[model samples]
Target: MRDFDFHPDEATVRCFAYPASGTVVNDESMWVGQTRQASPYDTMTEDLVLRHFALADEWFKLNATFDLRGILIQPGPPETSFAINCDIATPMVRVGEDVSAVDLFLDVLVRTDGTHRVVDNDEFEQAIGDGLLSTVEARRAEEGLVRLLGWVESGRLASLVHDYALDTVGQAPHPLPVEHWDVENVPSVAPGTRPTWHHG
Candidate 1:
């Protein structure tokens, strides 16, 4: 095994994500996001790092876990909302195909500035997915499944799905994009910028 550098100079950065409008960003949507804690031999933060790669490499929508402070960029919603959804069966929470388990670790938040506009919940997930995919290297044709498995174990991602009530294997053979994470939105990055989706 090898060690990985999971350090970000800043706890946060400005970025953009795909909207749930079923279209790739005509233009990048501006956003400010936080970085995860540092860990030695750490892979837990790969989900976040993979997103950074995705953003710099090309347009992509990825599934991820998040701590939404608020509609940092978007505006107010029709009403205030706060909820949590665990046991994520969606691809956003997948450890990998054929190796994901049942467990719940998701959050749902809705808050508005009470003016201008409101952030759509669907859009929020859409943006997060895009943000993660941006950080992660786009899926590989041959190694996509392999990388997914490696990421699952290397990053301690199994904890998220170790205790699912489903009582099934921690794997899903056919993973589908949530309503917003359609394959059309997953773009291939240009040459040179393509990140190597390595697992340590």
Candidate 2:
């Protein structure tokens, strides 16, 4: 197969999910977020150049991965928060479709200055202990997180985000009002089976 250049100006709806309330080791609440992007990939997938990040999130959430429907974002450093606009849903989807809405939460790395870094160690560890994640899967997630930290420390991530936002000027997706993400909503999706597309 030919390699994809991961050209910018593509639009896609992306999701970031966390462990739901009442699950084993339910130390945290649920956070479901989505973004319309000028590129098809998120920071983890874009930075690590691995589809693994996207795949891992889906496996952990036990839900169907949203279809990409667009070009994949290229492997590169992550974009800064300022570079992309995001909408986070409240009362995340945790149980049955007809379940009631609950408080929403996101697993993040918050610096002393109040800036935040998105991270998922808690979910990975909990899943592993619950026998939902294998040793190999946990290791891969750790590796990806470490690699992301390296880019942040070196300041490469900021530069990449700046460049991508600049390049995709006209093609950026229309932003949803920030408040739309705050609704107490439940998702209609059923728990997923092992994905045939998941290699890890």
Candidate 3:
């Protein structure tokens, strides 16, 4: 699980965890990371390249995947390439040396042909009803969703992805070796809390 800081209010920051793996690139305006997924189908051998983008104040996390192996069986067209997660959070901030971001749940699946679908609305609404998310947070999430859709409809997302992909080529190793990750021992940290891991 990837660790993040979830701010419910000005005075509270909760530790939020999500399943993901990648080597992160912290750019001036965004963070780009890439991970590899093995083909789920026994007959396929090629791996899928999943790229993640976290832009400043974008309110959404954009993921573009190159599924060369056709391993992912989703209800979309022949190939779906992008997924956007709308969230209510600030841009990633550095607490000493560790970097993390908050995640509020809502998603959009964009097919290769530019067609797309919004998903996880029920989950977002449920969070609001359960008091897991505030009304203001809900509004921010909705606004983020709208902005994300605009990026899709305007073809700006495609351009952004293409440029970022080019910028990341050979920048880092893909599919970060899990053998080197010690997530179980990684302590949870709140905003202003110093990371316990030593940088040696």
* Every candidate's CA RMSD: 18.8, 16.0, 8.0
Pull out the clashing pairs in model 2.
88-181
- Full-model lDDT for every candidate: 0.22, 0.28, 0.54
For residues 27-73, could you state the per-residue lDDT of candidate 2 as single tens digits? 12322222333435454442111111111122221111121332223
Identify the leading candidate in terms of lDDT: 3
Worst 10 residues of 1 by lDDT: 1-10
Residue-wise C-alpha lDDT for candidate 3, range 83-155, written one tens digit per residue: 4433444345554434555456677877656678887778777766866554555677788788889988999
TM-scores of the models, in the given order? 0.19, 0.33, 0.65
Error of 3 at 132 (Å): 0.9
Give lDDT: candidate 1, residue 88: 19
lDDT of 1: 0.22
